[model samples]
Target: MSPTFTMSAGRPAPLGATFDGDGVNFAVFSEHARRMVVCLFSDDGKDEIARLDLPERDGDVWHGYISGLRPGQKYGLRAHGPYRPDEGHRFNPHKLLIDPYAKRLTGHPVWNDALMGYRADSSRADLTFDTRDSAPFMPRCVVEDPAFSWGEDIAPRTPAKDTIVYEAHVKGLTWTHPGVDAPGTFLGLASDAMLEHYTKLGITAVELLPAQAFLNDRFLVDRGLTNYWGYQTLGFFAPEPRYLDRGRIAEFQQMVARLHTAGIEVLMDVVYNHTGEGNEMGPTLAFRGLDNASYYRLMPDPRYYVNDTGTGNTVNVDHPMVLRMIMDSLRYWVEVMHVDGFRFDLCSTLGRVGEGGFDRGAAFFDAIRQDPVLTQVKLIAEPWDIGPGGYQLGAFPPPFMEWNDRFRDTVRRFWRNDPGTAPGLADRLTGSATQFDHSGRPATASVNLLTAHDGFTLQDVVSYDRKHNEANGEDGMDGHGENFSHNLGVEGPTDDVSILRARAQRKRNMMATLLLSQGTPMILAGDELGNTQKGNNNAYCQDNEISWIDWSQADDAFLDFTRRMIAFRKAHPILRQKLFLHSRERAIDGLEDLFWRRTDGQPMSSSDWEDPALSCLCVELRTASGTPLYGATETAIFAVFNAGEAERITLPEVPEGMRWVWEVDTTRPDALPGACCGATVQMPADAVAVFVTEVQP
Candidate 1:
């Protein structure tokens, strides 16, 4: 016989299963639910021991406390109400639901017809309610003891200007690594071997794709694939169980601690815009079962959901209860999980207010800005969605950095020798001041990235012109068709010496541009070591070797060059300045902060900027009294780009008592240390070179 427990009235202020010294308090919010029942399972979570009705109703919240109930107890909820889809009420007590604020979950949902509230084979479809018990098919929410000895675990708190984000997926990053003892797990990512690699890469933070618990799509499962990118969130508070091999939530905390110990901040890529529940016809998971109208943005017709994220139902962040849940989840990650920051995925949807319009002064933004703990953490926004007015780049409020896609496109077109890209490239290299310079937002507000997880890797950018996403189970029509890539000569990997050499040089040029550019730089993991997805730009479902980082194929020379480039950026504070250069002299020094020039070493004129044929240009960064914009005095550097045919760039005149020394050249196999140049320098086609001035003391 299962152990029975007595209950008492619980407070509804603190939602979810909160464990006190005596027992656990269970609370959930469902304004439209007529009845709510909490089901307790056996220790193994297979047998339902008892069912108790939440007798207390404080406003929209139903809550109750169970004495003698401790941590490790498995439970779920069942709400009975109207199942009218047209009226936007999808409550069905037969379908068990996980707690919206579940700190930990016991199992992954086994896909079955019983898990759905609507009958799959019915002619009426979602209108037909199925009374099958989904308890056996669903995961049980665990009443967890939120206590861990986070000894000396402090946030790294890396400065925004100093942060170099390395985007990585936990499992894909270390699953195939030969050095890691615990592969495909959080412990493996925190292993000494992985930490050493990140340290060597010179990235201050690791922006993990998504760690929140998500559901596996039935389509992918049928095709022998999985959702490799954890964008489909199930439980916002629970860490994905697959990532924890042994220690569960404690293992995730340990990972954070280990990363912090290594001086690297952990920034999670969070998806609060939507849940895994696809559409009205989709599975009745936690949110849809508990309260569909309040949890999801319903259409005026009330039968369909507002699909803002392009993934079925958009989250109704405008609702008070939903907003509270999101805020609570974010705080939980920062305070309990010890994460340093968050990168909001498809963030435009979160800022949408009533009437389904994006608002700059949205309540979500205000809540974060007003929060004491959240305001201190680094906040980044993906800044776009597929909805109306969703392409909101550089429009976020203060302290919220946005991923600048214009920078990526401009850089790609410039290197590809596309006409009229020089001016755009110049703007991007200087932090895209056109987009982010307003509202007193600094240059750091633009997170400049040449490539990210959603697109092609640096290697594939020069190796394949078209996306080969056949492996994704979708025909060639899946990923972005306009990848802004070039195949050099051959389509895929070729042993041709000329093509290989050209591709390597192009990769180096792109990497140099990304690192040397102003604003925060984000390096896609495995890009420095020349990791490729073979032409599979969108490998969201290919969770095998197609997505894993192949350490054996690591390019040591390229990795060294990348490391040196990062070091160079760090050495020169001007490269990563917080302020956007306005071509004005600094207060400390009388020299102009930055200068844009044509290949002839003259300042770019209006006609030059408007010229469609111009492809090559030069940028000069100067120091005032040997001091950069932010840090201590550093050497002034001049960088030149030659995307056209090979040309001789007349080196700009150096300051008095100083000479130009070549520091970096993309044409060479490695960074070259050359003698002082007098006037002119030779640059190969589609290459970039850097020269720093030496002061004669």
Candidate 2:
């Protein structure tokens, strides 16, 4: 039996449940609540043991200290306030709410009618209140010890210029991984075999999809689907219990520590834009039950929510308490969880103030810029939303890398031989300087990616002309229509050798373009091994074989090509320069830093860039002297991409006593550096070739 203890008023400085050796102090913020109660539960989280009303009220914060409470104790909160949906005060003392700062959570929320704050079949909808108890269906927040022996765990802090981000879904990356001890879990993802794979792949960081505690939508559950991507966040500070092998939060810490030991940083895909509670008609599981008006941005009438995230509701980050909670959650992930950085999902919503627009000087951005810890970490933004003025691709401030969809489309169009795409491809190849060059930001600010989690894989990009989302259960109406993909004369997989060879070559061509571009490159996890989702561009609902990576089908040749490309990019610093490359000569040797050329070894004229039918181009990079860049001296690289038919192309002029060596040729089976080539090279149709200049010492 647990020991009985007296309850005392606790300080409200540090919010959430804080355990300090002897006892536990619980503090929660609810500005409109008339009363607050902390409900303590048993270890199994099924039985409620005690319920104590907070004795102290420091302004809008309710706080209390319990002397006998230990670290393993499970608890939840219930606030008493008006149940007026029209007024935006959705407080119900009967419903158990999750702590916004919960470090750990136990049990999965069981779907039931009691979980809903309002009646399901009632015509009055949110205006009508349900009095049934929701504690049985809700997950309990656990008071974590927060004590872990992280001996000598150091962050890799890989420089943005040299960083290669591998965006992966924790479960999807390892669910079908052969010979793993615990597949589809944090421990499985941090296994030695996985770490070795990442090391050999030459990626500096793993950008994981959302690992925060999240909810499986009832609609998805009813439709026999699951929220595999985990965008519907429930608790920010807590790791998703489903991903834990033993349901212990320490497993997450161990995963981070192990990844750090392997010299690979961990970047979480966080969703601070909105919560899983959703609109007024949605369930009041946590935030909506605690304080709806303060946590969510409501309409002028306060009945409906502002759906800026296209998810049903938007987080009111303009609110002081809500903003503080977000900041605290970010710090917890960095300080306690030891994550190196974050990639904000639907980030535009976080930078929007009340009634105005997405402002760069919003409180959320200002707070992050001024933060002592967050400012030092790598910050990446999705930089768009469904709200008004949402497509702010290159509008993010310094230290933030925005995902460049323009690069994805341009590269795709260029390889597909689309007309009038040469100029756009040129801009993307040099790092989209027109977009990210301002505000003292370098080329690294443009996170150039060909395909991300929401799109088709590299293999599918070359194999499927349209999205095949029939398995998603939405009558194939979902997913993007204009994927900028080409089927190469076949819709799906085929045994025809010609089509197969063409698709493979196209895949290699795009991969080469992505890796050789002058910006921070992000590779989709299974793209290196030629993983395909059978044309399901939006596999957010297909959690089966369509989403899980199949290690059995790993393509060795494609993997080798990817590995070599990454190694080549790292070896040649000219490809990953911090500053944008210009066409002027900065070296004493009179070699230009960067320049575009035609197939005939002549500099590209203004008319060439403007030509609508132009389907071929060459980019040359050489050593410069203006300010010493990252690479060695006396180095030069020439890359030729041909989207047209096979033709004889004259190689560009090399420096004083240098000869061009074929480094990578997409048309060839192997991309290894071969013998020196002559002045003119035979370029294959729909392929890319790379040559490096070596001086005769």
Candidate 3:
């Protein structure tokens, strides 16, 4: 490397390598580093041209300014300090590290032993230091121009009551798309074909599986697989390199603009709980090398890290700098990249501080709740981790939606005709009022999901009783065991028409139930087209055909059904409401906001709820009693959920000038509406039916 480049003391206001026309200002935080140098590379990013040490330090931050450097300059950092893994200070100057605020990277790291800070094979693992130069094996951060002409790109701020979230993986969604020109790239997802599909599907928002740059596990690579789901985040500010058609951040910006133009919001799944660098034995890529003790939550011994996320190391959100990094990353996505919101992965770890359990008042949550930029955008939490007391489904504060696992399990168990599920089903249908009703949080606070990437698809939920994850190379012990799913007649795939029909019906029932409930419904990407993983619930390691969406073999009927169902939900205001229905009588029409009934047309009693043989539940719904006059525009609605044998049930009576009209029937997809009910309606076995009030005049 050339030593000709000179450095001057620079201001340490905005961290990261900032190129401001004349040169670049380099600033990084390293509390224990003796010195830090910026290693500049050639245009091709292969040859090291110059190495200059940052000449000043404002508090804990190291800073320097280099003249005559341009926006496209490629560089890496090296911090000089003690390499004591026992005391939690692993500052190795030989291991090239990425800047924590790096907006773009040259490429992915070439996996090698030099990338590690210590000799992992030593008897005292991670205690022995290695002096291997790691610049040739690590990826370099590139100076970003930060200039994009976003001409008239307006964000589609779809209201929470009208949002239908479609969860999809960026590559898996576009890889096998027949109409996509550049498959498996961001541009492909924003292509005309994909946009048309999104608009036609009637989804207001698309919740993307992590688009952030991530690491492919070394062990998974050895077994001929990769980290396809991308939960292991390596760089928070950069987009995934594999998802780009050309090596540029502009491609990601263009994708966001296209989705916004189509009137669809984009929500990213973010992993801030932990990093790709696993444990003490893991590689020294970025954070572990920059400031190990300051960046991570170390254990009492200070040698090991707190593994609350089950991903080897939990981030120290309690630290002010660490919390600032997270907040800055989120704002960058919202302001610079034009993304709508984020769905935090393993969010329980972020809401916790030190040894205290998950708290809504934690620094991380408080920072986001009070931030001007972040409060305007949507924030969703995965709501749980492997840490103690981590299952915080409805415990999050107002304006922060949480992924309701209880909703998922309850819906599955109820549809499978499990005994004693009627009461649970009733609670879920009303947005689980017992859990989310307090703290002034609305019903939309619960992001109700029937299936996500972590578990089975809607088709597999009705076809496989247990998970089939043998292809993941973890021997069948990788995914969750109790799926609460039921295979009607046979396990795995079967051509039996009877079983196939039942499975399709079960899928429709769950899908209908989800749309009819009073929460934000999230549909797994291929559930509409009946995409199947062949019962593989956990396909995080399978990047090939096992995970990609097969467009050619799409279930046109079911897809049409899903589209119609979403449209139906949008058409009915009673289905998706902001307030919980508590059976209080409305002043405008003397009708109860919610009423539970039995087959005899009488209100449900305590004895009826306790009956184990009771498999049917009917509900009467209207606008909340406390709702203002402007919001009480909708009429009454009656729905029946029958899981037992088919029977005739009496429908609830309407007002003087209104009559009950058949609206939706999940048992018959092709069935037409506008059938005025008689004294009784035939409640189909294991099916759902909805009726709305109509004027007789």
Total backbone collisions for each predicted model: 0, 1, 0
Model 3 agreement with the true structure over 64-85: per-residue lDDT tens digits: 9988788889999999988887
Candidate 3 clashes: the total is 0
Work out the TM-score per prediction. Answer: 0.97, 0.97, 0.97
lDDT (10s digit) by residue, model 1, range 1-697: 3446776898896999999988889899999999888999988999999888898999999999998788899999999889899999999999989999998897688899998898999997999989889899999999988778999888889889899999999998998888897888888898999999989889999999899999899889889898889889999999898888973788888889999999999999999999999998789879998999999999999889999899999999989999999999999999998998999999999999987578989999999999999999999999999999999998999889999999989999999989999988888988999999999898999999988999898888999999989888787888898989999999989999999988888888889999888899999999998999999989989898888889899988899989988988887777888878767776655657788888878888999889998978788887545543444324578998778888888887866877788888888856466556879988778888888877645
Which candidate comes out best when scored by lDDT?
2
User: In candidate 2, where is summed lDDT lowest over 10 consecutive residues?
Assistant: 625-634
Candidate 3: C-alpha lDDT: 0.89
Residue 592 lDDT, candidate 2, scale 0-100: 66
Error of 2 at 207 (Å): 0.7
- Which is the winner by lDDT between candidate 2 and candidate 3? 2
Model 2 lDDT tens row, 90-179: 888878999988888885677898888888879977898889999999999999888889999999999999999999999999988887
lDDT score at residue 504, model 3, on the 0-100 scale: 90
What is the C-alpha local distance difference test score of each model?
0.88, 0.89, 0.89
